[model samples]
Target: MKMKKVQEILEAHIWAGEEDLEGEVYAACGCDLMSDVLAFAKEKVLLLTGLVNPQVIRTAEMLDIRAIVFVRGKEPSKEMIEMANHKGMIILSTQEPLYMACGKLYAAGLMCESED
Candidate 1:
């Protein structure tokens, strides 16, 4: 899915990277544990989490994640946003719960790395 499609599917609001919304996302990973993000996510995948911390952005940076989705209406801190901006990562916030958001995207053909 492309970033624009992801935003539409999750009903997410883009907090950054308006110009990069056309970027493509082949897979997704959902986790709140930053350590897990470091340990597992693959390249060019979108991260879905409820955690709103700078570490989340750092995790994305380390793994070269293209975008992040904050589920359950959560939003990141200003520092986190700045961190992601510096890394050129797209940030999105959605009112949908984590499971529902993941399900909706998965049903729309965005698979997890394990499924790939």
Candidate 2:
């Protein structure tokens, strides 16, 4: 699914990278543990987490994430948003809890592509 459609599913607000929203994301992984995020996320992934920090954006950059959704109404710092824009990443914020957001995306057919 596209970032716009994911945003609608989560009832989210565009925090940054609004211009860079026209991108595709096939899989989604929602977790607060940075280690798991780094290990599990693959290409064109939509990352949903409550962790708001510069490192989150940095990790997303490292993993080549297509977009980020800050769940549970959490918001990232201005610096983080700027960093995400610089890295050409889309940032989204939603009030839904992490599990709820992930569930919605999965139910909407944004299933993660496995290597099976």
Q: Clashes in each model (backbone N, CA, C under 3 Å)? A: 0, 0
The most accurate candidate by TM-score is: 1
Per residue, candidate 1 scores C-alpha lDDT tens digits across 1-116 of: 88999999988988878789999999999888888878888988999999998888877887889799999999888888777788899999999988899899999999986676
lDDT per residue (tens digit) for residues 1-116 in model 2: 98889988899999888887668888888888889988777888888999999989989899888689999999989999889878888999999998889888888999863532
Candidate 1 local distance difference test against the native: 0.89
User: Worst ten-residue run, lDDT, model 2?
Assistant: 107-116
Candidates' lDDT values, in order? Answer: 0.89, 0.87
Give the Å shift of residue 13 in candidate 2. 0.8
Residue 25, model 1: Cα distance from true site in angstroms: 0.8
